[model samples]
Target: MKNTTIALLGATGKAGRYILKHLINRGYTVKALLRKPDGLDFRHPKLVIVPGDVRDAETVSDWTAGCTAVVSALGQTPGEPLVSALAARHVINAMQQHNIKRYIFLSGLTVDVQGDHKSEANQAKSNWMRQHYPDVVNDKQQAYQLLSQSTLEWTMIRLPWIEQTEQRRNLAINLHDCPGDVISTADLAAFIAQELSSATYVHKAPFVASI
Candidate 1:
């Protein structure tokens, strides 16, 4: 895995840090994009901090050069420009340029996709998000559209509520429904790292949670 370097988006995000750590600990080199690289808490030989924003297509391409894969844990930020849609475009372009095939994106259950048999509870979660944070909902939904239309081997892992806690394993995975309410950050990290190479859910969106 030392030869496999992954370009990471949203390294400052709650899930991003843990994901980065998990990759580095597993001996996977990572190029993590950060707006404030000086604020990073730790360092490792396998981790390279790339200072930039995902919205910048040029920066995204430059950051992705020579990387084997891409993983994003980007989430919407209040009072900031939309993130997910732009990240999708830029990342896809970068991936194409490098001919990279694997992309694993972190998203939520609020985005409705075709073939999804979301339960009433999940539908309600989407409705509430659209009613309140409509812009974010729109952006993230657009991100999904872009990802689905691409030919790349992509997995959009939808999560429920997230909590910072001890690392857990043996995640419950569902294709038609969200099987649980919450997942720990460590577990999410583990899943992403594993899914990067597993191709277990390629070209599909799966709901993952703690069992």
Candidate 2:
């Protein structure tokens, strides 16, 4: 918290809000960029909300400038044009410019990369995405490509169906398969918060679900 300032995008979305709260409550200084600043309701001394869109390269660069690490909880919009890949490019370029080394990215399990060996059932999920939601899948895949090829240290936490229920369980993570079909937002937030300094999965993509 002392030296680790976080530059967060998608800070207003469902998962992003939880991630933001976790980081803020944990005493991390968070600089969050939102299209609508008022989307955030609470305030903390360490929380700074910046009004901007993630797709704008200059805005993302400026927002990311002084943060020690970047945490992107950005998600795809159903009818909106692709946003993740473009945003990732901007974030990566900014990280290089600012010398920020860590990037913790959250995405759906459908984003396939080279080292993944998901089980049949898990792989089916990605296949379905590609068949029906090609744009979203393609966008996330490009984002992964950007992350993997970038110089900054990165960890992409691929998630299953996200639930908002209070029901809690132990988190199950695997490099080659998804352990379950769903994960609570609470559990996902905790895992991401812990990953910031853990370095356990840096430069790797892991499938996560609640068990």
Candidate 3:
């Protein structure tokens, strides 16, 4: 882990901040790419906050130049397609240009198209989203498709509804299904940190959380 330099995109977000704290505490040098570096409160000796949008290919490539891996907690708000698509494309190109193979992205559970191993609750949730927020789901699915087809060694963590809870890090992982469990942001950060240290699910997306 000492030799690995991580370039974390969306470092100002809720989950990104947690990952930043974990990386800093573990003595890993992280280059955090955010929309505004000045707005962030966390300052660490090992943390380098780079001000930029994830949609900018040049900026993304510059930030990831010497990085061993990349972690993206990037997402879009409801009814926003441009930002999500642009950022996904930029990340893909940036990783390709820099030859940084490892990538871990946070995608929602609703993006899972395959129905294998899906619990009843998960199925219902998917149906609900399909009936209500179809556009948001479609946008996320497109982002996942881009990552899946890329040559980059990427793992898309399809997270369930996240809550800030006080629980142990005892989450179950599924390859193509939801875990039917809620997860805390802290626990998610711990899992991401663990994945960063070890290349367990490279090139494979998995559902994660404590059941």
Candidate 4:
């Protein structure tokens, strides 16, 4: 693909790191949004490290400029205001203004997509999140709703517990159910990078896990 420039959110996180490397290795230019410049290790001619926060509209607008797509691996942390919903709103607005399409968002199983027939184990995990991390779960659910309402082509990838391994295991991709147990960070990044130009899950949410 020509001019494969992408605006990446959460580039400093565990999954985000793998995603940065994967996209770069796939010959795509990446504009990574970061709250701080600390701890980032990737440097390349195709990589543009933008220092900014996702919640700030001005920063997000700057990051999305001249980008063909957006990929988010954003996650909520304790004591921090759940910003994924707000960030999604900002991203969607920018994409509309800039006429950019194709967005890929990373979500967990707790945020159920429509027609989702979650397995017993997934249900238990969702229940646990409701009991413990209600704010985080609620924010993610709101974020997914925002994506669903957008006119842009978007895919929300619901992932299981992500391990920091280099294993590229087989990932079961399903539309309505949790597919497997756990997927490695390497495998998840590979899927995201490949899905950037794919229409398989456009306007849909797919649950992915290791089989």
Candidate 1 total steric clashes? 0
TM-scores for the candidates: 0.97, 0.95, 0.90, 0.97
Ranked by TM-score, the better of candidates 2 and 3 is 2
**Residue-level error in angstroms, candidate 4, position 59:** 0.9
Q: List candidate 2 stretches off by more than 4 Å.
A: none
Candidate 4 root-mean-square deviation in Å: 1.0
Residue by residue across 62-124, what tens digits does model 4's lDDT show?
989999999999988668888989999999999998899999999998987769898888899
Give the local distance difference test score of model 1: 0.89
- In model 4, pairs of residues that clash are none
Model 3 per-residue lDDT at 172: 87
Backbone clashes (count) for model 3: 2
Displacement of residue 7 (Cα, Å) in model 4 is 0.6
**Per-residue lDDT for 53 in model 4?**
84
Give the backbone clash total of model 4. 0
* Candidate 2 per-residue C-alpha lDDT over 1-211 given as tens digits, one digit per residue, 9 for 90 to 100: 7867899988888888888888888889999998988878978888888889988989988999889889988988778889989999999998998899999999888877777788888888788889999888888988899889988889999888888764568999998777899988889888888898898999899889998
Over 1-211, each residue of candidate 1 has an lDDT whose tens digit, in order, gives 8699999987877888888888888889999989889878879888898998888999999999999999998888899998889899999999999999999998999987778898998889988999999999999999999999998899999999887765685688998889889978888998898888897899989999987
79-139 per-residue lDDT for model 3 (tens digits): 5445666677888898888888888889877777454567788878888987887777787
lDDT of each: 0.89, 0.87, 0.80, 0.89
